[model samples]
Target: MPYKANVVVRYKKSVLEPQGQAILLSLREQGDESFLDVRVGKYIEILLEAENLQAAEEKVRKLAEDLLHNPVMENCSITVSQDD
Candidate 1:
């Protein structure tokens, strides 16, 4: 079966995000205080063949942890769906 994976990699709650803070400052300066806080991260989607939905999810998770994100400072999650 073929599956689609949606991955999100973001800094841990306890980690500091200088880029996000800079963006927040800019937004506030532009009079956009609508956001309480902002954090920047990566979003990736990939399609791959897998034995099953569980296997697809596992592969996606591994990619996220092994390549897409830094496990010590970041957290990652994957959502899987059938491509067919």
Candidate 2:
């Protein structure tokens, strides 16, 4: 069956996110001080054929590790589900 994988990639806590910081600064300038900080991340969706849920999850995780995120500075989370 076909499966859908959702991947979220974000910088590690130790890494600085310049883009997010810039956004936060802009918001503050606009009088939105409610947000103390902001962090930017990437979201990706992949569709593939898999034998089972386990297989789909494993495949998506591998893809996230190898291509979706940078291990040195980033972490990734993945979710796998059936494609309707």
Candidate 3:
């Protein structure tokens, strides 16, 4: 079976997000003061073969932790689904 994984990587609260801050500043400069803050993150989609949903989730989670995100400075979330 084929599985799809969606991974989201974001900076930890204790880490400074310079890119996010730059975006927020740009938005404010464009006259968008309605936004208080902004945090930028990365979204990755992966397709892989797995025996079951549980196996897919576990593999994707491990991938996210090992290669997709920095454990010290970033946090990651993963979603796995069957791919047709």
Candidate 4:
């Protein structure tokens, strides 16, 4: 069966994100003073053939940790689901 992997990659809490900061500043300037902070991230979806959901999750997690994101500065979340 084929599975779909949804991956989200974001900067670690301790890491600085200039682009996110810039966007936050812009929002604040636009009268959105309630905004505190912003962290820009990437979303990626991959489809792969797997034997089961567990296997799909494992494969996606490895891909997210190895190829989809940099573990040093970024953190990743992977979700696997059956494809229609």
Q: Per-residue lDDT for 1-84 in model 4, tens only?
A: 999989999999999999999999999889998888899999998999999999999988888877889999998888899999
TM per prediction: 0.85, 0.91, 0.89, 0.86
Q: Write the per-residue lDDT of candidate 1 for residues 9-71, one digit (tens) a residue.
A: 899999999889999999999999898788998899899999999898888888887789898
Worst lDDT 10-window in candidate 4: 59-68
In candidate 4, which residue pairs get closer than 3 Å at backbone N, Cα or C atoms, i.e. clash?
A: none
TM-score of structure candidate 4: 0.86
Give the per-residue lDDT of model 2 (tens digit) for 1-84. Answer: 999988989999989999999999999899999998799999998999999999999888888877788889998888899999
**Model 2 weakest 10-residue run by lDDT:** 59-68
lDDT (C-alpha, whole model) for all candidates: 0.89, 0.91, 0.92, 0.92
lDDT assessment of candidate 1: 0.89
Cα error, residue 79 of model 3, in Å, equals 0.8
Q: Candidate 3, residues 4-82: lDDT per residue as tens digits?
A: 9899999999998998899999999999998887899999999999999999999998888778999889988888999
Ranking by TM-score: 2, 3, 4, 1
Deviation from truth (RMSD, Å), model 1: 1.5
The candidates, ranked best first by lDDT, are 3, 4, 2, 1
